[model samples]
Target: MTRAPWMAVIGLVACAAPAERSLTADPGAETTPVRPTHPSGIWPVTPPGADSPDTPDPPGSATNCDPLHLVATDIDETLTTDNDEWDLQIDDPSYDPAMRPDANTLLQGYAARGYTIAYVTARWDFEMSDGRLASEHTVDWLHDHGFPLHGGLVFLAPEPDHDGDEVVEYKSGVLLGLQAEGWALDWAYGNAETDIEAFLLAGFPDDSTFLVGDRAGELEVPGIPNEDAYTAHLAHLASVPDVRCE
Candidate 1:
């Protein structure tokens, strides 16, 4: 994989946390604390108390010690249909878009075989009116809609209304950070040219990149067209080897 420069990955993580970072959750709001980064610049967002802090990650969960398989995916259009409801979702924290057919099921199959899911989106880090960060809404949506969450992560843009180039940069930065921290990103899913660019920039092979929704069949992008909401892809995924720890 084309890894980002170590300094670039460090810079990206530093930018994610502003000078005035707050470790405490907002009063009375369900929140995940954005912890200080480990030396490698990747921080876990899996709710702290969900599993014992000292306990090692189970087989299917992501752990840096083992070079496990990981699947990186986009949120809008790739996983959900007509997800332009971000503004509405911010105003009404309960608003959710319809999930693409079989998207969750396909990812679950990968997770079952020990692949960690990395939800990389261009959504801004703005706080909703309900006091939850946009990332919180994303997590809730995934859980409410039955997506796999075996130690998965949700990566968001540092700012709002990202253009295509900005989206590519941010998403690529997230992938690079994961790569630096020892995750083997074997496959990637998306629905935009930006997603294609990001995945390729992060060194994913064209055959391993799948694009859904309107841009799926575009001839210019370097990704396999997944027009059937991953229904057909599930069978192919079954044949890939599972992760084996050293």
Candidate 2:
């Protein structure tokens, strides 16, 4: 917690909205530079070199970039299960929102063991009008619901009044601006009660916090509940090891 190497580039412009422009609903690809080991070939089984979402540097610090085991979540009902009527399905243009069975295969098995997901959504920084940026349609709906956004990072909510303590002050201010750059969030996922009070007010670790739909386990904070399927919490996060910080 000895931050200030530009505090993760000013916490990526004060939390959310900056993927180096070009997403006017796909003007031939250009978004995906929020860092997490790059690889934004817009996901289709990338993972070869991958790490160039414009590289403004903010992964870790062994002098700059290396130790980053970050995992975070919260996409309407903790990865969409009836998407809690997202304000009456946000003007339903053929709605279509249903994920949460395995919740993107448990965050693509925590991005294939290297962590770094961070999709902390309260979804609302609207700017649509053919000018794009409702967090670029929530990163094309997490790449059309296949999640694991290349080298993921989607955080949104600068306005549009999310209510309830402003969605716990905009998701604990994007997890305290990714813990002001040191970033070791480790694990997080939610379904509300203001996402366990914004992940214990951005300090995380009530045994790695998890919860899904219907007030999961009625939260008293011991977290880990995954309501009805992350298939046994993705086998209890594959035996939880790989501490990603090399």
lDDT leader: 1
Q: Residue 241 of candidate 1: its Cα lDDT? A: 71
68-113 per-residue lDDT for model 2 (tens digits) = 6677888886787756545444555235566768788888787767
Note the Cα lDDT for every prediction shown. Answer: 0.65, 0.59
> Which stretch of 10 consecutive residues in model 2 shows the poorest summed lDDT?
1-10
Which candidate gets the maximum TM-score versus the true structure?
Answer: 1
Candidate 1: tens digits of C-alpha lDDT, residues 1-246? 111111111224336443322221123444443434533233433433444233465433445336857799988878887567665677688777778777899888877667778788777666678777665567667866778764666676767766888888888887887788787879888888889889989987777887777666673543444456767666776676766443
Candidate 2 stretches greater than 4 Å from native:
1-21, 24-63, 79-82, 85-89, 92-117, 120-135, 139-152, 155-185, 192-206, 212-215, 218-221, 224-246
